[model samples]
Target chain A: MTALAEPIGRGGAERASLARRASGWLVLALVLVSLASLFVGATGLSPFAFLKAMLAGDAVDLRTKVVILDIRLPRLALGLLVGASLAVSGVVMQGLFRNPLADPGLVGVSAGAGLGAIVAIVLGGLLPPALAAAMGYALVPIAAFAGSWLSVIVLYALATRGGQTSVATMLLAGIALAALVGAVSGTLIYMADDAQLRTLTFWSMGSLGGATWGKVAAAAPLMLAGLIAAPFLARGLNALALGEPAARHMGVDVQVLKRVAVVTVAAAVGSAVAVSGGIGFLGIVVPHLLRLSIGPDHRYLLINSALLGAIILTLADMVARVVVAPAELPIGIVMAVIGGPFFLWILMRRRGLMMGL
Target chain B: MLTAETLTVRLGAHEILQAVDFTAHAGEVTAIVGPNGSGKTTLLRALTGDVAFTGAARIGALDVARAKPWELASRRGVLAQFTGVAFPFTVAEIVRLGQASGTAGAATDLTEQALARVGLAGFAPRRYHDLSGGEQQRVQLARVLAQVWEPLDESGPRWLVLDEPVASLDIAHQIEVMELARAFARAGGGVVAVMHDLNLTAMFADAVALMARGRVVTQGPVTAVFRDSTLSDAYGCKLRVNVAPPSSTFILPHAALT
Candidate 1:
């Protein structure tokens, strides 16, 4: 037994170090990407000059201050929050369902939030004038958050019975829900005039262009709350990878884990969608890439997903800002373009595993 | 001792398990043997509190159904027949999940020892998905072992509730696992295994419970329960029990005449 144990001790140590190294590198990458994002926008304001001016307490130009502080700073912060929320939510959903393909967008949570935002946009005029005026710009996000919670509640009700949740049922129900919500959103779009149609188009296509201090302030608390709650779920999610029965046997309250995970995903994604629109693929792609590089230990995976998700989204937002120069491209288009092919590659590589689906 | 009395399970309109009484003593291996659909797995589930059942089940002094999951987890470990993991997890990571029951101190050392005991030394870094079916089963067994690494705690004895643990292993590995069970029992732990291979069962199990159609046909010490008529009637076939030297027995099923 001693002879057999010798090699394992070395291997276990090596794997532990490897995970540590991977996490270290991901953190470094996130910091570098964030710094680069501050300088890579269309306004041509050098981050170095801005930093130097601010540090020296010298007179700074108004355009540079507005570009850096007003626009880019809030945008960067929103990108980080939204990205981290979506990615963490994706990790939770995948672990909860015991399937790699589970994502907030694919599972209809994002669609539900999008519908909520659209309803607020299209129907806000119907509210009594005083009430609509009082809600101000906060109405869309509030409505979107409410919509997200409602849809998740409905989805949970449909997918779970007798303390067991069926992943297949959840996925199918998500697809159906997406279609139903899309139809309603389309009807709203048809009723809208040209200006409302423009707002709807930009919102649906997904962009960080509209990021503002108010939006960031509104969404950050919910996203932060969800992100903080995620690490506590690491152990339960890890046990769940072995399947529900084995997870329960490991002393994890599987039912409670499911409830917490669903609520977390909904709150995070709902707040994100309310602010950033339906940013596709970051949730799915970030966690998938991290799992490929590092093993599926949710303890490390959740943190790394948050870091990498933030990095990737910030970089993508930079691309969306610069690729079209004076005219910005939607961040959703950028993510979908990169993520769609990567998703296909993962599917092809894991074709045998997908057969079980 | 782990005890279950008047356990009955109903799913929809069908009864999966009828009223059944089971008792597995500490420091012994109890094997439940039966044909397919004999409710062997369901019985294990009920005992582990994985499924709702109308019965009284207790491990030591705590009622299984009412005990807190984490509290129960510290005392009992379970191995399911089929375990499907979605992401790529290393064997070590999978084994370490057993520490979720709050066995944080010494968990790493115990995980390594557990893997070594299952003949999977140096497999800590190996991906669980890349392993063969038998290897994965052993990995799961290693996880179970890590969960109950110490056979006895402040509590009297721990329990290992397994569902068809060796159904996927090769012949040699089957004996290896059975030997682990025997060793565990020797160390003063309770092991209740749902088994299909009667030869292995006869060799390793101190007590045998034979079941047919959701009911225990007969249960007792190995020698008394391995009688020819009881097994033959329960299995719906002709079986002859051959007693071998060193107090072992083997059951052979006779072929039907054309």
Candidate 2:
């Protein structure tokens, strides 16, 4: 009889009504920010001017028109893709690892990707100009994805004991792998000439300067594929959040689900890293925020986190573009400047959640 | 029909359950009882093919060892003690997951009915993470119920496997769930539970199976197995046994050793 007070009144229409209202406000806020991105840049474009430019498909100045379409629009689109990928990846990592403090980058995945890109740059600089010119920017991102996937595979192999993945051992192994990759990165920096060092520094900090339509075009399809595949994974993920054995009992192929999530996260984060560089913590922050907003159902959580992540990244990138007008700061730096404080707040606010980390 | 033949399960160096053999008939509640680490949960998992076992389980001409995931899913609905809910799924949405064929037909309605059976009606639209532990279990129970809830002709052999189902429930809900399991068995479904409470097991179980060190020590009708000597042996200590006037059984662990 005790602890059964009022049956918790399953499906109170009134509570559902409130949740819907909150979601409405969140969506509305995102819309306003997206629209704001069109106008609130260094260019003296008004909301009406930006909207007209978007709809009318023309501008008085050809350069301005090109900037809106070629520069800002693709930048906005890439932001959305990267954001969605990181948020979804973060949520998946949390479930897959069964630790609230867990993030996709926990297993040295992003670090590996970053190191891969840095190495590509080092090797490319050594190559003859004709060969380098043929490859263009493609080699770096491709190398990054390959390295990231390899790191994930190694971590998975290391962390798995018998058939089960131990959450603690995985985390520890991730940390160790990250340190090793990080040391490699540091050595590269030490050996590089000023130009390579500069490139390495910017890439390591993360950036959206490389946000061309080409990169966005590449990222969009993979992001869409991940977003589509993510919601179907909710049932298995929700079951996993309890523990592996419990998930297995509920007819969830626990190991299969883990593999699916790991691969999905790898692909999603790998592509995001390929384009935007090593943007830390957006993956960690957005999923937690979504959990706070909606209850912990992956069906809603996955989609909402994607949207929120896109909206936040766009808004942050907008700030990055304007903060030092003419010489735009990299968006990754902007995110860190904002994200670091918020992360501290979260750990302080949710100590219990951080325990498993 | 469920039969466990000399099942021995080991975890690390600990022999949690050893050579356990028992059979549970359809349309009856079979309760497995013992102290902590006596391997009750392991036996249930072994039966469902969730864990590997040294022996085999035969259910209606099917072997547990070679059964496919879907094959096992169709024959048994299991509720592990700790069900994780890290995502934000509505209660109804969660219950609907038990739909193997992925349709919202009569079976879906039965899921809602099952939730109602566990006093979780109208909670369907609520977020799962916001609910208490007991509420989550009911939602899980509803999910299992929906998985097993089939139409008349397609109603194949199904067994309910619950590991500590009532551990997190309130006293009232505990009785409600016990009564539901009893009713399901009465309606031709099989029920196997790993439970700790001797009193509730006495009230609802048709037969009692005892496990120790990963093996079924003995199993029989409730009246025969739930004796002072059996209780003492089950816990590896001397234990007092009392039969209440209301036909309920009681047990206690005797004092410490040197």
Candidate 3:
């Protein structure tokens, strides 16, 4: 036990406290950004006016009430759900692959879901009239979910041999799968008429403009379920960082972890993409930023990523609303414009550190 | 104690390990030494359940193949030869992963103590990827130490299975790591390490198992296995065992005349 004497005196207490403080800060940012998003739309509803109306209580006008409650609230809710879902799924996928660059979009889940949505839109005529009419608006999201799960299952199978999963193989296979799916989606778009083509294009660009209480209700449960189940994965993912053999030696069920991570990413990203279309970068950006800031302890990174993901996406949605004003820019474009440069910066900084690509 | 009987491993068309019968007892350091591709690593992997194998390998009474990972984890810790972590985890965080299947209690203190034991007390917050190769290897050693901190558990003795634990270390650090393994064995734990340094192996190992061409050529007390002829035949080279001052053993490979 004498060997256990403290050799160096530096405190290990700082990281936990730093993580706690960062979590508090992220939550505060989420709240502030959500409030700003509620008032920053093209409707000319100023934050001051909104605050005054809130303070007045029951004195607010019908137009203000409708804009705040019926429109902005649902959009904010959907944005929060999609943001949290995408970011947490990113953490899971990255940890599972043991690579910072691994993302749901890069791994073909978003593309698969996009293809599924396109199929529903373009090929809906092929379904029985009664069934198509009955499914109606719900068909695309359901199809998208199924497609995402299918792609991930295939990707997981292809990338894994025996009990080991190769991150490089997963990434390369994902790119190939995405290209294959994209080509098929393109063919579907070619067969579509102008209106269907417009829908497909708009969905691919990714917008929160179509947010409604119905969409919010549909996507919320799945996202919440995934988020709630995510923290339980922290310990397993942490062990996995040591490589699979060591992780298994440390008592982590590596197979179970892989299955759970794949399912969680598929469910969460699948639902988000179903509702919000192809919102890119939120997954990769938020987790990488949080890891850089707080270190890669998944116990802290996952929770903080969820909060910061919500805040950043909400703020980005706000920018999409006001930057052009009246006519909305797709939130996906806003995120890419912001996240692309940030990703490049990360790569440049870690060029020497990134081994095995 | 760890025991393997008639263990055979085949990867596709080639046999990696053949009928490898070995045993490492509690309170002893067992060193497995062989030439490159001599199946020393493969044998270690088979013993730790890292690779599928035929025949029997057991940690205490639990079968290596059938035992649950968590069940095995509480009894033994393993240090692999190459641990390539992909993220920028701190030293403390990497070590804390060892506690994943440990009994829930005060782990932070244990983590710090483990680091301190490896001469890395204040390194908790240092980025693991940022550390030098030798430092990173020690951090991994600290992690394994933390997993089975108590050499003797309620269920008899624990074990440390390491694959070339000092391969990346300097001479000073190599001795330090070897001393750590010796200390673990002295404290009633079992140590099974794949070693290449014959001098260090002779200095620390109570028992030596020599493998050549996927088979155990000789295994027993150091005196019996360190004979020059046995070493020469196992390594397929003319080797001289030099008895240094104070009975330390060193193996020297003879070079051909120019």
Best by TM-score: 1
Per-prediction TM-score: 0.92, 0.83, 0.92
On lDDT, who's better, 1 or 2? 1
Answer with 2 or 3, whichever has the higher lDDT: 3
TM-score of chain A of each: 0.88, 0.86, 0.88
Whole-model lDDT for model 3 versus the true structure? 0.85
Sort by lDDT, best first: what order? 3, 1, 2
**Which portions of model 2 show Cα errors greater than 4 Å?**
A1-61, A128-130, A161-167, A337-357, B12-16, B58-63, B68-71, B84-116, B119-153, B167-175, B227-258
- Residue A346 miss distance in model 3 (angstroms): 7.5
Please state the Cα-based DockQ of model 2 relative to the true two-chain complex: 0.33
Candidate number that wins on TM-score, 1 or 3: 1
Docking class of 3: medium
| Interface C-alpha RMSD per candidate, 1 decimal | 3.8, 5.1, 3.7
Q: Compared with the true structure, what per-residue lDDT tens digits does model 3 show for residues B167-253?
A: 999999999999999999999999999999998999999999999999999999898899889998888888888888888888777
lDDT of 2 by residue, A1-357 (tens): 111112222442433343455456667767887777766677857667656766887755776677677877787788878888888889888877765668888876787898899888776678788988887988788789888989989998998988776667878998899999989978877778888878777877677765788888777777777777787787788767656665655567777787778878888898889888878777888776555444455656677778778888888888888888866787778888898897677557655443212
For residues A119-211, write the lDDT of model 1, one tens digit per residue. Answer: 998988899999999998788878888889888888888998876777678888988998999899999988988888887888888888867
